[model samples]
Target chain A: MLQFAAIILLMLGLYGLLTQRNVIKIIISLNILEIGLNLFIISVGYFEGGLAPIFTSETPANPNFVDPLPQALVLTAIVIGVGTTALGLALARKIYQKYGTLNLDEMGEN
Target chain B: MLDNIEVLQVLEIVIAVFMVVLAFLAINSKSLIKAVMFLSALSMLSVIGFVVMQAPDVAVTEAVIGSGLVTSLFVFTLLATKKVGVK
Candidate 1:
């Protein structure tokens, strides 16, 4: 079910990317795509009643943990996602300044 | 698992569904501010889903960075453009 949601989110983002002409909208689509990817990665490492990978004295002996590797990858992905989002928004602002309009159709290819 | 469907599973399903629906609305919304707001809401919803999936680290990071910081950044950018500045 989680995978299904992820796939749907990717589809929605892709559709937005292809159809939307607004710069902010395009950035938003990219964000949705990243969110879906992160969700899918975490879902792959999840299982019923698995323990979180945090180790401490409070944890029990012989703890059954879900894959910690995917969580790490997702952490990196989320950070990269933030960086990319900021970059995209910056580019959007530059585009707005260049064309005096956020709509790509209005700007055209000059 | 089929023999006993847990409430947590049911809740997970509901959150995932809401996440997908919000993604749709956020991407396709007509207003830019509205889209950003929808995305913020979706991020918070995903944090809940992350906790349910046993990813506490991701949930904490997402709640702080994804939902809060990113939303504020987007709003700031929008305001800077003066296209939808304070009226």
Candidate 2:
């Protein structure tokens, strides 16, 4: 069920990307899609009853902790998402400055 | 319990629906600023959904990058551009 919801979010983001003409909207949609993928990745590590992956002197040896790999992967993904958003917005600003408008169609006329 | 799972399923469905609606609005809204706001809202919802699904790290990242930095970037771009909607 969680996977299904993630897929739906992915599709919705894709639909927006394909249909939107505005550069900013396109970037937003892309972020939406990225979030969907992130959600899917994190959901993969969920266990019914898992402890946080921490170690202490009193910690038990029982291995019931959720996978930490996804957490690491998501940290990387978040950094990448920030970089991409910065680049996309910078490009949008340049597009706007050069064209004086945000509409792609209008900018294309130049 | 079965009831808990059922409730979770219902919550998931609601989140899915909200995501779809926000995605559509983000793309189709006439005002660029409004679209950006919608996108931010979508990101926030996704973050909440991630938390509910037991992904605290991802939820934190989404709230920070998706809702914080990205929204600011969009607003900056909006300010840079002349106010005009796609015809």
Candidate 3:
């Protein structure tokens, strides 16, 4: 269920990227894309009757823990996503300063 | 009596639908700040969705990092831009 939802979110993000004219809007679309990607990746680790990978005193002889590998990878990916978003926003600010407008059309050959 | 699993399943659907709706709204919003707000809301929903899917670690990280940090970055960028006064 979540897998499909993530896919739909991805498609929406892509649509925004293709159609949006503003630099900020495009960056927002990139964010949407990353969120959807993370969701999809994390959803892969889910399973019925699964608990978090953390272990504590409440152990029941054996336990079904969701895949920790994907979770860890997603943690790293989230940090990277933040870094890239910051970079994009910085570039956007520069674009605005240099071009005096964020609209792609306005920036064209001006 | 609904079992915990059943409730979570329902939650999964609700979060997914809300995520999609919010994503759509975030991108399509007329005002840039409104779009940023929608993106933050979507991030918050993703945190809940992660928790539902048995991902406490990611949920905690997302709750802290995704919504607040990203929104602030966006808002700051908007602040620096000329002719686009915060509205």
Candidate 4:
């Protein structure tokens, strides 16, 4: 079910990226695409009654835990998303400074 | 193995639908600030979805960075552009 939603989000992001004229809106669409991927990965690892994949003396020796690999991977992806977003925004700032406009078609041509 | 699968599945479906709506609105919004706010709201909903999917760690990270940091960064950029004195 969540996978279905993720697919929808991916398409929505693609639509925005293709249709939006503003640079910032394109960035937002890319972020939405990242989030959809993250959600899909997490959902793939989920199981009913799954505990967090943490080990401690207090924790029982045997327990069902959700797959931790996807969580770790998503963490890395989230940080990377932040970095890319900052870079994109910086480029947008530079573009605005150069062209005084954020619209895709209006930048650098005039 | 939840006994009440129907209710939980229905709730998840509803949340997912709302998330799609928020994403659509965020992309379509005219004001950049409002669009960023809707993006934050979408992340918040995803945080809930993560928790419901049994990933609390991801939920925490999403709440902190997605809802908190990203929104602030976008706002800062918007503000920087809006203030003519800065440029």
Best candidate according to TM-score: 3
**C-alpha lDDT of residue A50 in model 3:** 88
Task: Give candidate 3's TM-score.
Answer: 0.95
True contacts kept of each: 0.65, 0.65, 0.69, 0.69
Taking the tens digit of each residue's C-alpha lDDT, what string does model 3 give over B1-87?
Answer: 349889888888998999999999989988888899899999999999788778899988888888889999998898888434342
Candidate 4: give the clashing pairs. Answer: none
Expressed as tens digits, the lDDT of each residue in A22-48 for candidate 4 is: 888999999899888899999889876
Score candidate 1 by lDDT. Answer: 0.86
Worst 10 residues of 2 chain A by lDDT: A47-56
lDDT per residue (tens digit) for residues A52-103 in model 3: 9998899667888999888898899899999999999999988988888888
Each prediction's total of clashing residue pairs, residues at least 3 apart in sequence or on different chains, is: 0, 0, 0, 0
lDDT scores of the candidates, listed in order: 0.86, 0.77, 0.88, 0.86
Cα lDDT tens digits, model 1, A24-59, are: 888888888888888889989988888888998988
Off by over 4 Å in 2: A47-63, B1-7, B84-87
Off by over 4 Å in 4: A55-61, A108-110, B1-7, B83-87
* DockQ for all models: 0.71, 0.56, 0.80, 0.68
Worst 10 residues of 3 chain B by lDDT: B78-87
Candidate with top lDDT is 3
By TM-score, highest first, what's the ranking? Answer: 3, 1, 4, 2
Candidate order by decreasing lDDT: 3, 1, 4, 2
